[model samples]
Target chain A: MRKIGFSVIYFVLVSVIFILNYTFEHTAMVSYSFWNITRAVLLIFAVIVFPLLNRRIYSIAVTVLKEELRKKTLYVIFIFVALLVSLIHVFGKIAPANQHVFVGEMGLSGITLFGLLFGVFMSSTAMYKEMEKKTVYVLLSYPVSRQEIVMGKFIGNMISILLFSFLLSLIFVVSLLVRFGPINSVIVYSCFALMLEFVVIVAIATTTSTMLSSTSNIVFVIIIFLLGHMTEKITHIASRLEAQRLKEAAEVFVRVLPDFKRFEFKDALSLGTVIEPSVIIASLSYALFYSAVALIIGMLIFRRREVDRL
Target chain B: MDHVIEIKGLRKVYRDFWYRPKVIAIDRLDMEVKKGEIFGFLGPNGSGKTTALKLMLGLIFPTSGKIRILGKVPTDVRIKEQIGYMPEESYLYGFLNADETLDFYGKLNGIPRARRKERIEKVLDIVGLKHARKRRLSDYSKGMSRRISLAQVLLKDPDLVLLDEPTIGLDPVVSREVKDVILGLKSEGKTVVLSSHLLSEVQTVCDKIAILCEGKLIKEGNVDELLTVNGETEIVASGLKQEDISRIKDVISSSGGKFISSGHPKETLEGLFIKSIKEKQESKSN
Candidate 1:
């Protein structure tokens, strides 16, 4: 608890400094404070927070990672993805403006595809499979709470997603550097945005999975993902409609559903939107806050659920 | 003596899609099990014995009632730290070895690494799975799988243990070993609550028993007191048996009573159970 309290305090302190830096973009002191805050947050996470995470959650996370790691197919999947990207690079030679742009676009797409797959599939099955196999009976019989189980599984899936993203990102970036000689700095932001997007995707899947089966959960979350991308359009339609009832309903949905357009790093880049610091902060905070809410809701539902029924 | 478990007016009614009462899995029932006693939970299929155990573990919510285990509500995770539960089926993760499974459970209980290792060895030894500790559960025989499950349950050295059909599918040797383990737990001052359909097994280990019928407690008492026949007597004779038997017959004739045939000195629990049920039905019809 002390560890968590310390971490939260440090995080808020750093985030305040970071926002202040953005607000006073021209101030030398604020920029220096921003650098120090960034470094301190990274160091705190690596040195203090990682080791201080709840032991039960960490153990569960490791078990999940080990289970997926032992499957031995992740390597094949990565290789398969890299080969597809290489093929894309080959197609780039048919002569558009520059091959690097095409390669970067295709590479980022591959990362997003794999990361989403990792997040969605693992979240759906992590807890469901434990219950299906009745392995949960023993685990639940221990001193662990339903919240810890849900959080542990969520963290497990997140770690798995992180590793998959990193490996694929490496493959994409390495392939780009070798083939195109230079790469854009915008790709870093794109990867970060993709990861944040997955955080929401995985949390939504985790939340729905408590009540739904694996297949239904996957189907439901896929529909949610699709609808999330179209929330902007839905909001516009809600405003310009004559039917007050439907408009109210659409407005409710727009308020409830996550506006995925917030994480549209690629769109912002392509349109030369300058990627303001406040925009980046807003997207980051939205993704985190949304994921946290989804997880809490999942825990509450799972807390009330009967494991025997599961 | 403190009651290790106290359940009052416990009812669990599983609902349907429309939020209507569907099946009353456990009707209003009350039970108390004391510390250091092997409490047997006996019932036929679908009689709510398993449902009762699940309720004690807080795996399911009771419709209306209270359950306190180890002086705390079942849902409290602190009570779980002191309770060990083993379900009927020992189906665990097929991908894990016995050590890995026990280690995972130990970590869940927040046991330190060094103590967990020591406790793991002790439990593996108890379940007689020390030799197969490194073997993956998927490759284990049914008995081995069950033993490993038992080992996991004992990993935390819990104060109260709940076993649902602990020896259902095992051979006689293994079943006997499990019964012995239950007895050993009693010897160690730990409370054991076991649910089983095997009357003979329950009769052997249980000091007190509860007979549940269709989600209601039909009978509950000390095993010896419940099984003892009220108006029956038996005498064992050794030398001059024929002469003694003839004299007993003559005495019986003089007393205007017929002697009942007897082979073994003690009546089987199975026979008592059937007789009890028949008398119950006859009384209900009357």
Candidate 2:
């Protein structure tokens, strides 16, 4: 049932993107067509890379999956997302004739919000829980590398977050179809961008958890998320600054933190604006690059960390 | 003469958040655990026994020094395939049932599915937890959880088993059973490194023992050699009358030897506890 559901959603998403790309191309919207093509390419690339995961990484990931399943954390989060999505009608009723757009915005926002909560909460606690419980001793005693543990955890938590996001997005899609009547393909692009943002959040949280306590890690991740979203504005302010040193400091901050605004498509989706394919590819590449760097830093810290601290 | 574990000048100094040296857990420790022997690591609380165990298992790094397990670096992943470790506490995933816990560790060791299935059952039976294998570890008593911990350590049939206070909270009966399992592993030519504060238990099972105090080895030798009294002797005999006792005393006096006090031998509390349980079982069978 899950596979079929996922397949149908996937097929519908692809078909919609392609159909929109053809329509936009005929109307001379080259940028929109290119964006769709990039989306299709990224989808294909993800499908290809997922199945070739390492065996050790797969085992750790499976353990994390089992832990989450047994703890029912995923179930609770799914129920919350579902309940929030279902409650969107209350907001829809208060809106004007374009109530469908309001509903879509609320539904997507709920998915992103709940998905971030789950992602940040789970990732920040992943390593700390293992240490506090002393389970890392047993795990490290096995024939697995510390890098594998960090990577596996990042992969596992990512999977859980993605699964929940997928479910919530499905509900949102259904809600859109029922109320909005053949939802725009831009919504699909927004969801993809939201997922990419989650990938960055998970990586940062996972990396921070290796060195900090869970609470501190969560705080740090949230601060980074906030700072990341303000990168462009911060950089603009730096460019306008009269003090050279302050301008340079702000510019450095901009360079250091991720530009989360790059992954924001909600405004475009709502305004029915076209996104360029090059922009989509560049945003995805940036996310993947940042995630890899974060994961690498996390693995290094994890490898050097002493389990005796807990 | 083969050493399964070797450590030399090992030091572990823990640091605070500011990177200031806070505690010196192990200080220039040197030790070697030979193959196929049950080596006991005896120390008081906070005496660095657990720290040393963690260092040996590569769960923690040393500040300065070297450690090798199974002739490989402690952190070498390949060495873990033949090593089993049970922490001072159970440290198990509370969400996983006993069966799942064992299965999880088995997978980490990269054991094949067929062998893991067979060995999981075997280890569970060895630890007398076969009946409760379906129960979540969180629901288990302290003793039961320790047994499951032991079961996971033995799941891979590891050649070198490092058990840190394996019988800490167990009942006398269960402690005896755990010691027996340790001995059983020795009988299979597997090297067992056991750390505990229970001196009697260590004396009973360990062929050689090392006592650490304040992160330093105060003593290390054969159990009997370290425990033996140079000038004293104990003699036990049955059905001896008072006259026989006097004659023995006379002989010792004539030889300029002092006779120590003598009394009927008494079983230890642990021994008596185990014996009574065995007798109860025997009577029920009869």
User: Which candidate comes out best when scored by DockQ?
Assistant: 2
Cα RMSD to the true fold for all candidates: 8.0, 7.0
* Share of native interface contacts present in candidate 1: 0.81
In order, candidate lDDTs are 0.79, 0.82
**How many backbone overlaps does candidate 2 show?**
1
Tens-place lDDT digits, model 2, residues B1-286: 3999989999989999899999888999999989999999999998989889999998888899999899988988888889989887888888889988888888878889999999998888888898898898999999998898888888878999999998998899999999999999999999999899999999999999888988888889999888899998789999999999999999999999999897799989998999999999999999
lDDT of 1 by residue, B1-286 (tens): 3999999999999988798988998998999999999999999999999999999988888899999989988878777888998889886777778889888889888899999999998988888998988888889999998898888778878889999999999876678788888998999999999999999899999999999989999999999999999887667765656677788878987998778873446676545665776788899999
Error of 1 at B195 (Å): 0.8
Model 1, C-alpha of A49: deviation from truth (Å): 4.3
Question: Every prediction's TM-score for the first chain?
Answer: 0.81, 0.81
Runs in model 2 lying further than 4 Å from the true structure: A1-52, A276-282, B282-286
Q: What is the C-alpha lDDT profile of model 2 across A97-194, one tens digit per residue?
A: 76766877888788878877888889999888888888888988888777778878887887777777877777777767776678777776777777
TM-score of each: 0.86, 0.90
